[model samples]
Target: MRPDSAVSVPDMPAIDLQDVSKTYGSVVALDQVSLRVEAGEWLAVMGPSGSGKTTLVNLAGCLDTPSSGSVWVDGVDVSSFSRRELARFRAEKIGFIFQQFHLVPYLTALENILLAQYFHSLADAAEAMAALERVGMAHRARHLPGQLSGGEQQRVSIARALINDPAIILADEPTGNLDERNEEAVMELLRAAHQAGKTLVMVTHDPTIARYADRRIQLHHGRITDISIFSEDDEREFDQILSKLWTLRENHEPLHDDSLRIAGPLSVGRAIAAMTARGWLCRENGRITLLPPGEKRASDLIRRHRLTELLFSHTFELRNEAELEDQAFKFEHSLSPEATARICAFLGHPRACPHGSPIPQGDCCPAAS
Candidate 1:
């Protein structure tokens, strides 16, 4: 929805910061920051705590103005807007999703969404309910924020953010308070919004979460230190190598330098050395073993692989062992933890795959007996 409050200037970026700096007395939050968020682009801002990630999002959302230079949103110079104008402009053009799930304590789920609609334009009950339904939260429309689970509350917050049909969605650590399943649910909604042409500027501390964006920027002491664009081939190679190591460990087989099984099309020796350098695994006394962090990552990947096997077996009724293994290998890396959980739940949380191998328990699985 185009906001009437701000006139669109031709050839201007969707969200732009020109040499912006923000300070609080003796402390500097952002220094000489210049950023441009293109229309329909997803940009991730990543940094450690006290690294000015939040400050950058706040400026883009128009929640706070820059101490120097200018901040512009939707081609308008928001830095020059009056307080009332800024509020109106933000309401119409920007939607915010906070990590804290900032729903009003006293308001019910539906009511909270209506509040956002009230701010943006006329509050229509039908539209608000539709928004909740989109996020699969319509059944709990009457529940208050206090009565909902963390995931439920976040879903309600998402509904509220989209109620206005804003062009830009600013999210700050949106999945910070969620578990694996809930985080997947929240990301699915955000991905849908991005697909619908909403520009997303999200601040995150998790590398996995940051990978969802088109580009990622790292902040250090209020300065943009690095920018990264992802390559799919790099990720695929890493997953393939890790999976081979995981299989060896799970089968109680030693990963000796002469283990030809692990040496596939890729240079297995170099891959193992790289993983060891990254602290994902260790090579000692001519044997290789996974470190704690690497074990967990490999476990998740294996879980996804077995779950995919189960899904394919049931859906396609395929009984060929080679076919199932081939399909599972190709599809496993594409499944998110959340999607794997759903597949597991759909299959009644089976403990074993079609080949009778025990499936690894995911976070969404019930406790083992």
Candidate 2:
């Protein structure tokens, strides 16, 4: 898609690559690639080991710059930003989550998170606590990085990232060092943050994990080679959820909070509360209603969530429903409405979710455009 044609054109993209090309002598690290990611979207950059994934992340995170073309973040073309401006932008709007869990061994988790605040004018203990709480790491706030497990350390890293309240998070192989269980745990935290409206971009070789992204773009020879949308599994899952919602709607059955799972890091109750506060919904007893009576918003949320899970399962070849379901739940909510719609369309308007239920239509997907 043309950069200008992206949804909400004037809105500063969380990250934008315009004909960006990187080369070292005869070796092309990336070639004239263009892409746009809106605020609050999770995009996975995937490719073989040397496919320029890290190069792209470095450029987007402001750690480096493109050899050609332009890179924009939050609407500012940062290709020519002064050194001070680059440092300020990186501190204010971008957070990096490294695979190595680069926490100070001696500092407590709280202190590590607080370290990021030193660059800013406002710093408070409450903000630190809230960041910890957001990552389910509040209980471990006082623990040193050495005392925590790999997963726990990653969580601390995430909490640190949150202290900045950045619009975009750049993670590089965040789960690479952990075992299966730990990997899942770290991913859960990342997913949850994404759902809460943070913009996230991660580099991973694992397709399963990549599936958690609203859009997966592959880089080869330093150029974008493919962009994968939602797949069959995604459609199946959407159909299942839609069926359930429709059943409840038709029977006039109270839409029990327990019956609906938002497929996000936050619980259904939390999701409902947030959406209601934003005027997206209204709830009375067991029944929840879309406040504006618009199907599009609801569909957008559902489709994004389902497609995220589907991508995880398909990319990773994960066959366990419980595993896939857990991953999907956190991923879906991390997507922007525009990215969500693209995923839904890519999946061919799947009638059911992976678990076998109808997928509800949303405003994001217009009727036969």
Candidate 3:
């Protein structure tokens, strides 16, 4: 049997990949990639589909082996590990969050977490329940994956991942399948994990989501292309607040503490305070109103939202109203002005959304069209 105990090394990087490549038949999945992730660092890997983002993650997490070079974790060359050893190493040292959640369909939330423990060590029901409680899913612990909502299932998946107290987390588009509200909730959980000093490596397509990491790297055709360090910013929070304000304006609702329902990581009061400080909005006579800059930003955001709705409804042929709305909400914050303009033009400068409401005119719309 392989060594049952993991040798601990002082001040070692959490993950290190040197000149690693992977090929499936004639197709090269990853091309000579080299990366190092420090302990407690949060790193974002981004690229388009088939760009080797997931492949790189799979190699680092020991879900797959590299075709060449070294794969090291906790200062040990995992490349030399047998399949069984790799499985044990993964259970002991890594936590994973995925877009699809991947919970056992027949298992209750609590049981799923316990299953993870069963693999690493002995199962403990109390510890499992506590893990669920941490993600606000303890009440749903008895429910099976099919009975839980998308967000709840993801919460359960997270609890299971963290139940082992793994040193590293590998999240592949963790929020991809979630709606805006759920996306925010899930991201908040990830932020908590990062703050607690877990080494995080996440694969995401959204720039806003990637900005959450300490640093982000771009991959292209299986090669590293660009790497950027994150700059602290409140742009995401501002966008969300502005989106909420725009909806209130559309519905002719007053912007008050009770009326405003801002979702995501930021609390309602904190979001409002930040907006007030940024001169995006103001409060007088116990009423809040958007300033010019705020108004412009909100209008643009609304335009993007409606455009996204159109893109889904008309282009993608999505028929479910709820799904369309959810997708539109998720995409609005990420769509670039250039892409929005191209979409507007592609749709023949449509004047109305699918719901018979006027789509706010973009600059790309022809005059008098």
Candidate 4:
């Protein structure tokens, strides 16, 4: 069947995994998983580490076979195909964007775009040019990947992914390495691609990033914990809980049943129940503590909030204390990790927030000089 044949009457899922499971020896990567992605839709996969997000993507992309059960793509059982046939499916029907920006250092931007075509069909320079033009990178077609900045290289990678005009795009943390502006640049391209009818599957840890998709699924220990089509109200509630947890962390206080209830509708009990279920909180002795994953999430939120304060105070020349606080609240949610890192790097990794609390060191911070 043609790749585009995935178009259905809104009832048939584009990709389906029925009772699928994958194991690496004793490690269960995906446990009897089943999922569906509709044609021309965008789906976001989210989970904490070791939650089987990557395994699902690999199986769907035909990069790895499930240990048991079955894998289907575009309504075809992919596990039935031989190795060569699977490779052909990937070449003809899938495009990929990786967080690592996997580009050939020796190839020019134009050459990289043409590389995808060489595998699936003849390499056409005009076709490659059009791909680059779509990504606003036509002028730098002759430049090698190494010659470009992080964002520029990522843009070129986006061009390469589009060269095939694939029906599906699989992106694993596509904005992972990009710093602020570049992350947005790449996401814009992805957003455009989804709008143009490709089925998109992306894995990201950020709720903000996941919000860009039409639906999101959360996984844990190889099981789907929650699947949400997402309403702003739900995201707002989650963000509220995250912020409240950060405040408790800052105070060095163990959260109790009394501590939650940051925003609308979610009661303190419901919040703790939800957070505990997600492995974000542990309740013992009537107090709650954040796990490693929770700490990381809370830390990132704190960084964004404070970094926004820094930007408004200095970059935007805002001086009113109250006004800056309001601005920071508005700016915090949309800031990506890359953007936060850039701000931290640019600010020389300041040790304190505007409130005099110490800022946590992010990966982008230069080693102490």
Candidate 5:
């Protein structure tokens, strides 16, 4: 589409890439890849070091053009645009969050937000203040980037991103520089942004961060390896509870009043309340026991986890259980019944994980005994 005539379709995807590749010298940053992000969707990109997560984000944000493919943002082919056009398009359509605060050192938090609007057209003090207020940073609007804490600066960055009302937001390791408390606070704002109809693409090394997104994709050696779509809140919640139960069993531990610590960032009291309401857990003699249904659900989780550990070991030859642990957790949470069964058959239903943990026998596996 011509640059002037290009217009976004509310129902169509906000970002789309076809056969995209990015290379630098002899190193390939991203391989042939096609991806689409639906409007209003939150997508998380995850990978280890040098895995091309940032390369993908830079392409999506129009900071760099693909070496051998096409990229469309909001229905326009960005690579076709001139430098001026690309700058204008980004000003109008994209918002960015970075690991560093990247705020002007001398600018007040409120002025920093207005800076983004100034680039796009004209600054509105009312809108700038409102953006900061939305992120709970209004109280510190006059603080300089140097004067604000890391978390506070990040909040200002978020406000700046939203100030322009961009259709798409790309955040790279946004919380990597923050403490745990600040990480949660910033993530809550990102979630709020997603809920407000912005297409969000975030790249991070942390799985906990990925859960906030509606879907997550894993990149490895410049290629997409795994994608998990969390379409239902109930399903993710159930998976979380079941995974926690298996963890307690594996460690031969009993539940405590603070059992939610095992679930990571979840409220122990709230989880217990929900579990009680859902009949997933029952208290007996001060011990939490999974009901029969809960036990059955947790068994599947256990099986998937063991199988995933084996798969990673075989494919990557990980040196130890710790090395395979995160990959196993991600796979276990994302794998479907059908995919789990296929792995069960492919590994000939291994009787044990590398760590000597018994692999539960599923329908596709031979007898455990």
Candidate 6:
């Protein structure tokens, strides 16, 4: 479907924002912004306080409407949804996670997750148990939120978000309440969920945590400042290309101009031309196919892209999706292959770009090592 037509219908963007704006009297919480997040994408929203990160998420999750512009979840525009429509939309399409666990004080982990299902139907204990199991928290399912550690409570919260099989999960600092170790643990769970094809968008101040996203978006003073899928550096050029390819594998869409920023101006035509000149590309069914060195080269590029995205997302505390991608693109092509590989190892072989694409495999990925 055309991008424009999809805006009004029940579309499937884990989250979609189109020239969306929100204002409170004289204060603008969000300026005009347009973004689209596909299914299974994990997008991190970053910014300093009052940058409109929360406002954007609220708009996407149906908690708030844009003062002007449009908000769509899974293709359905909810800008003017009625109270019942809003409630139903939230119940069927969105799952929310906050810094605070928000578990009912009197409820066990199992009960907490089950309570979420009650909105749609009667609470189902068995379903709740399965949800807990998915988060690796089944053993603690009977434990009350207060009895669990911050990380554990967060896990229960995540399970609750999943109880209804939501199309998108909106996480606002899911790791904020935990220490370093617990934060890592919670991030691991989130990573697993992303790998399993859940669409996730998170708002976070912690750059390190944000690196776990498929894409990082930075918001500045109520406007999108930048977006990134990788980091910058000479050695990372190939990795950026590979990363883009992995992300676009299923769609075959041409890389966007913004994406080109990651690895310099080397266009797909240029990359293919260069590779073909070197006997690395073979045409197959009007599409380019990699052979031998082609795959290796692609893998190297992906490694660099992933590493760059990781580093910049951490360094700048970027949450705005566009800014993060721009930063990664600027420096990703300069990293040495060895350095890029090391960074990838440090980051635990991320499977997709911040926008949720599989990371191409070659000498730079974990298995390659």
How does candidate 3 fare on TM-score? 0.65
Best candidate according to lDDT: 3
2 versus 5: better lDDT goes to:
5
- Residue-level lDDT of model 2, residues 1-369, one tens digit each, is 113223443477778899998887888888898989888889988877888999889889887777899999878799887778788889977888999999999989988888787775456788888888887899999999989988889988988876776778999999888876678878888898799778899998765577688887877778787775665554344434444564667567767677786474455665555444333457787677754522444454555666776667667777898888887776765675567667777766665667665566655456754
What is the Å distance of residue 228 in model 1 from its true position? 1.4
Q: Pick the candidate with the highest TM-score.
A: 1
Summarize candidate 3's per-residue lDDT along 58-77 as a digit string, tens digits: 98999888889899997779
What residue runs in model 1 are displaced by over 4 Å at the alpha carbon?
1-11, 241-295, 302-328, 334-361, 364-369
Residues 1-369 of candidate 1 have per-residue lDDT tens digits of 435523445566789999999999989999999998888889999877898999999889988889998998987899877778888889988989999999999999999999998887788898889999999999999999999999999999999988888889999999999987799899989999999888899998765677789888888899998776646754566566667777776688877656634434346676566455444678889787777757777777877888889899999887899999898888876776667889989988888888777788877789999
Q: Evaluate residue 295 in candidate 5 and report its C-alpha lDDT on the 0 to 100 scale.
A: 73
RMSD of 6: 15.6
* TM-scores, one per candidate: 0.75, 0.60, 0.65, 0.74, 0.64, 0.61
Residue runs of model 4 more than 4 Å from their true location after superposition: 1-9, 23-28, 47-51, 205-208, 248-254, 273-285, 290-369
Give the Cα error of residue 21 in candidate 3, in Å. 0.7
lDDT on C-alpha atoms for all candidate structures? 0.84, 0.75, 0.85, 0.82, 0.82, 0.74
Q: Per-residue alpha-carbon lDDT of model 5 for 264-344, expressed as tens digits? A: 344565555545444457876667888765676678878888899999999889767676898777667778777999998
Q: Write the per-residue lDDT of candidate 4 for residues 1-369, one digit (tens) a residue.
A: 235544455565668898999999999999999998998889999998799999999999999888898888877899777789899998887888988889999999999988888998889999899889989999999999889988998899888887877878999999888876787888899999999888999999865577799988889899998876646775567667777777876898767766774656666666566656555668898877777766877778777788778877878878888999988898877776787888887887887777777676778776666
C-alpha RMSD of each candidate structure in angstroms: 5.3, 17.7, 15.2, 5.0, 17.3, 15.6
> How many residue pairs collide in each prediction?
0, 31, 0, 1, 0, 58
Query: Residue 190 of model 1: what lDDT?
Result: 96
- Candidate 6 CA-lDDT value: 0.74
What digit string (tens of lDDT, one per residue) describes model 6 on residues 201-288?
9999765566678788889889887676654332235445545555565476654333444535565555544434333446554565
